[model samples]
Target: MLQMANYEFIRKQHILLGKPIRQISRETGYSRQVIRKALKSTKIPVYQLSKPKPKPVIDSVQPIILEWLRQDEQAPPKQRHTATRIYQRLVDEYGFTGGESTVRRYVRQLRVSPPKAFVPLDFPPGKFAQFDWGEVTVLLQGKQVKVQVFCMRCTYSRKIFVKTFFHQKQESLLQGHVDAFEFFGAVPQTVTYDNLTTAVKKVLEGKNRVEQERFVQLRAHYLFESHFCDPGKGHQKGQVENLVKFVQKQFFTPVPCVSSLEELNYFLLEKCISYETTTVPRSSLTVGEAFEQEQQTMLPLPPQPLDCCRVVSVKSNTLSMIHFEKNAYSVPVSYASTELTCKVFAERVEVYHGNKLIAEHERCLESGKELLQYDHYLDL
Candidate 1:
């Protein structure tokens, strides 16, 4: 048992530091022979190797296979010519006499190697957050419509925050982060996300990434670094992926409704808090209590909340109305021809001119044909 323990300790140290057996022996004052023996004796091979055989007849067809692979590089993956097909084509079109097995062996060698994906071994509480988006059908004014849910989760604590939005645009994505951070009462050190186009514009080699300007600004404002998962790897954000289902079942199952987005968000906030108060499976502590403890370890919140909404200049149309989304809002008759900036949020719309609030309208409740009236603007 002692020998086994020593072997495990040394093997683990080797894996953690990625040092060679000779180097480990040199540093630890163990004999090179002993280190080598221990590694050879205790190491469990992941897969057994097959016995080597004489080079096959396929070696002669390597050049042809390589040529065909190169020619098919730009073709669609499914449409790409395979070795078997190539061999058949050669037999039918040309007079080549190569065997199918030989051609397949050569073709296997020409396949582009799959890229290695990064997998984190362990992530500590408040160290990283993973985010993703999910969609669900919910009743809106007795009619069912699809709603997008933004899901974020802390890797270590398994704490989750979910919010529903209409779209997955940059504005919604940035606003989701702000709301998520505020919900958690602290900011994580690093955020992990998939290659969402709203956030990442391009993912360069060596994992060097370029993000949209607004997302970069949002990260800077929140003082957290961003890590993007490789494209086509949704499981890289597994924590949030799991939370998406959890939120859908635990929170959205009954399909609650409200007259406005503000009320819906208010109910969502309450549900999130209530979820945090329940005991997390396999852990004795409630999520809220765990989050409170986690919060102590996290960075303090910023003095001011992030301004996630965007200001857009809108021109009044001939009907003395301004268009925000598909919905129209009426301005004063005197200001019908003037341009004004509209401050849009998840639930509210505020029209302003030089810091002076002109009209505040609670955004339209349902999607189609809804309008914020001129008489309503006068009350504000």
Candidate 2:
């Protein structure tokens, strides 16, 4: 075979080089008929054809395997069933008598679509802060549990603020930002966030975005703009992502537990301050100190703290009441059941009757349901 290939190569060169095939045959001491055939054929050497391998019985199960794969693809990644589990299920539920190898081959053929690329970003100083939530599992009162930690980082300063909460619902999410802004003592000109449902209602193309009404009010209160990264492009806020992992390692590595979320957040804030102190001590600058300097450049806090509470009219026909989130308060019984405005701050609620203070009460705690006793409104 090697010799035949070499002869074919030389014959082609002779023909292209304008040498006569008969003279080349004579010089090479080869048969005139063989040389004539090679020149006339003008075809590359055709290797012997190997027989096709027989299709295994697994090929028959391709349809079933593909159907399973499609179903898995449509399911959430966290909830999607695994291949081995799916194979066992097929055997038990569908009475699939196929061999394991067949199932494995089909599963290997399934491919997941690649995530979109991160959009390039150029962050300006005091311009953007990236926010995210991370879940950390810890032993609470000897019971294993998970807590959501809110993480925020300034893109330029690299300063970070972390706070833990029981849930990531809208109230907690908005409250986290308010607390973070207060902790930094400033608000970024433009804040960046993931496509969290709490903040963003819908994301449109051409950098247009729609935000939840409450979140929009939150933004307006702070006088800062909002931007969201393309879905799944977390690297757009890589600083905060690293900050989340850094907190996990520095604070949660040993799985420390405390009596309450407030206690955990207190310690986490202290640790963050300590870490920032060590980062640039020679310059005598801490993260807090740098943030204080940055605050000078930031937009001043609104004339008042942002109102994070929601307003709901109390359902009473006689006695007027106002509901601020989960807790309810009673106002003048005169405006009862009528729609009245309520102003809620971090720690207090002010019930108004057309710009008149009808009632005021400290926000209630989980145990203090009767904070606003209706009888107290008798004098009003």
Candidate 3:
């Protein structure tokens, strides 16, 4: 291949200087045939393959690889098979004798596709936030356990809040918002979310949604609007989606060793506070500075935050216990066989008799367990 500059020189020498092709090739150390082509046309010379290289081993497994790639389109993003995994699977299942590099090259060719274009989105300060749930594994009591993480991010300041829970139930979802509002000291005008079952009961056409009743109550209490992304389009709330990965990599790396979720949450809270002082990419001010300015425009906190809980009405059995969520919770003996309201919180369960609180106990995650308070049975 001839450089553009050399090609120009060769053409100029032959056409303008009246130099012969033989003389130009001798002077430039290029072949006579090359000098002739360059003089004939001023275009830069490039080498083009007449045909693609053959892949003997990989060709045999193309169908298998294509099948796997198609299946990956429906699989979870994080759990999709990587190049290494594909190679291992080939060797194990098909006794593939090809080298990993060969398979990787073929896979890369198959995976290449045109990229999608996106419009840049702008959000006003204190007006928008996004929420989502992520999963991570942490060491609790020296044992590895999986936990759900509730993540919220301010679209303007990029401020983040994260908390871990054992489940992604309705109670956890509501409590996450309550805690996040307290952390920000104000409420965003509108919060964005996906079509999560905890928040949305049904997704209608376009942006319309049949929201969960409890979730609507939460919005009404805080006087904030809710926005839900389109079905299967997680990129609509792209800020919080990225925030989930950022927290997982920056905070959850090394698999935090802690005694309980409380200890882990406290550490995470401290980390989030510390993160405010650092600068974000393509921004001059620290996150804390932006957050401070954004706070001025945010809605003021209400006189009281919403009490997030799931209320279940049940009648106490003859055993002076109310069964909820497949577990029996002891109430006062006097309330035996009486109707009571069970308020289930993320951390505790409270039984209320005619709006008067009766029994309170730590919430048990497991089922079929009896949570008996000795004082509740004292009358017996």
Could you report the Cα RMSD, in angstroms, for every candidate shown?
13.3, 10.4, 6.4
Structural similarity to truth (TM-score) of each candidate: 0.64, 0.57, 0.77
lDDT of 2 by residue, 202-253 (tens): 8899568888999998988898998788888887778788889888887899
- Relative to the true structure, candidate 1 has a C-alpha RMSD (angstroms) of 13.3
Ranking by lDDT: 3, 1, 2
Colliding residue pairs in candidate 2 = 319-333, 319-336, 320-336
**In order, what lDDT does every prediction score?**
0.76, 0.73, 0.91
Clashes of 2: 3
Q: Between the candidate structures 1 and 2, which one is better when assessed by TM-score? A: 1
TM-score, prediction 2: 0.57
Which pairs clash in the backbone of model 1? 276-288
- Candidate 3 structure quality by residue, lDDT tens digits, 98-198: 89998888889888989999887877889999999999999999899999999999988988899999999999999999999999999999999999999
lDDT of 2 at 322: 56
lDDT of 1 by residue, 1-380 (tens): 22676677677767777888878887878777766666667754343447855555655555766777787878888898967798987778765676787777666766758997875556666788888999887777777778788888877677777788877877788889988888888999888888888888888996688888888889888899888887788887877888888888877888876665556667777877777777865679788776776777777778987787767998877566788778888776556767888988766788876677767776664545556465734634
